[model samples]
Target chain A: MDFFFEGYLLSHGNVIGFIAGTLTTISFLPQVYYVYRSKKTTDISLSMYLLFFFGVLTWLVYGLILGSPPIIFFNAITLLLSGAVLLAKLIY
Target chain B: MDFFFEGYLLSHGNVIGFIAGTLTTISFLPQVYYVYRSKKTTDISLSMYLLFFFGVLTWLVYGLILGSPPIIFFNAITLLLSGAVLLAKLIY
Candidate 1:
């Protein structure tokens, strides 16, 4: 879509930002999957996820205030993925 | 110092950003401490840290390009802390 390119694919900086965002965002998936399959979280730190969730949440709000789709999109995904890990840590 | 306030404490948004950055950056400390104390990393996902480290590195580069101190500062701390965890995961 034109909007996609304009939002995240236009400039080289934006492209680099997109890649950086994608790497960090998707990075959480393996952790989520790992915890889901193993159902073990003894080694995970509760405070880490707690702080991360809140931090990501704040970043989401920051994204909202800035009206940056990339920030909002990436942070939202990060929040969900990190939240999954946090939830797994709580449950298991 | 005037520079400190000007850099991170001037705008309300900047203050919020600083807090968010602090929360996420320091979040890794507990994990590092946990792994250090227990010397266990069975539950931690290797791919997650691998991706995260690179992602944070890219973010650091992005920060350098933007010449944003907050971005650079926060990401540098995150890189170190996450790297510590990744290192521990590799070792133990």
Candidate 2:
């Protein structure tokens, strides 16, 4: 019974993690779109995005080490999206 | 031997995760500083921060469910920082 309960909790935990990843990953979309449309990133911090880019990159490596496809996939998309924002901060 | 190697990899994975978490969490500092200093968030996306705020909040709850202090601690800080950004976006 205890094992069954643990498995149940673990499964739900994975579900929540999935949702959390999806939400946070896609959250960058609005910022990217806003920056692209406005062509303004003066208010955005270059250092923040730069650091975040590296952080996401590190997460990518972590995912590879863990052999977790979901982590790899989400972080990959996040890297691209955040990279776009970082580029906007640089160019615009 | 296999179990020992698995443990080693898992330990290293935890270390990497710690670093990744620290990096991503602190990355918000520059943006917060920039917004506070510039008093301009016109280019910062309201939707993005709004979504991110909730995402972090969910992570906090997820951490609690998982009974993981590191997850809770990091997400809590992220919640505060992202919340500040969201508030700034709304106010300025």
Candidate 3:
């Protein structure tokens, strides 16, 4: 808790959870960045993104139910990140 | 219990976990297939796949520690799938 005294407060477990969750959640960014940079998405699969977004959405719900801030926060961000990729796959 | 009596056995919670896990794990296949089909990997990020593989590996270890069948099963598959993608990104 003191680690957050400067600004934020999170349990050690939550901090660990956030670390793991951040790693997984942000992993999607590179793909999105690739697409954004290349402007080519035909090689990417729409079905994959669709299924992935669905799964992430479910995780967000599960996190809410579980009252896990790390899970909820990371999944929410992932949802948006995945949604952007899915949109790119559609638009480009 | 009855669900598995015919051939397999898994609790309802496990069943649900498996369903969600399957959706996320199998989602990696499409990208792998795309890379396999197109053989174009310049746009994809090596860092992203590297990070992803690491994250999945952690999940796998966590699953093994928890003795959660669905987590173990899915993370193992995801490791392979993500590994395949990472390999493809490297190879092609």
Top candidate by TM-score: 1
Q: Give the TM-score of candidate 2.
A: 0.86
lDDT of 2 by residue, B1-92 (tens): 25546666566997888888888899999989888888899888888898888888878867877889988999999999999898888888
Model 3 DockQ (Cα-based): 0.27
Assess each model's interface with DockQ, reporting 2 decimals per model. Answer: 0.45, 0.54, 0.27
Per-residue lDDT tens digits for candidate 3, residues A1-92, read 13434233222334544455677788988888888888888767788899988888877656655566776788899899999999988888
Off by over 4 Å in 3: A1-17, B1-16
Best by lDDT: 1
Using all chains and alpha carbons, the TM-scores for the candidates as numbered come to 0.88, 0.86, 0.77
- Which segments of model 1 are wrong by more than 4 Å? A1-11, B1-11
B1-92: candidate 3 lDDT, tens digit per residue: 13424233222334544556778888888888888888987767788889888887767655554556776788888899889888998887
> With candidate 3 superimposed using the best TM-score fit, by how many Å does residue A76's alpha carbon deviate from the native?
1.1
Q: How accurate locally, in lDDT, is each candidate?
A: 0.89, 0.87, 0.74
Model 3 chain B lowest lDDT segment of ten? B1-10
The complex in candidate 2 yields a DockQ of: 0.54
Which CAPRI category fits model 3?
A: acceptable
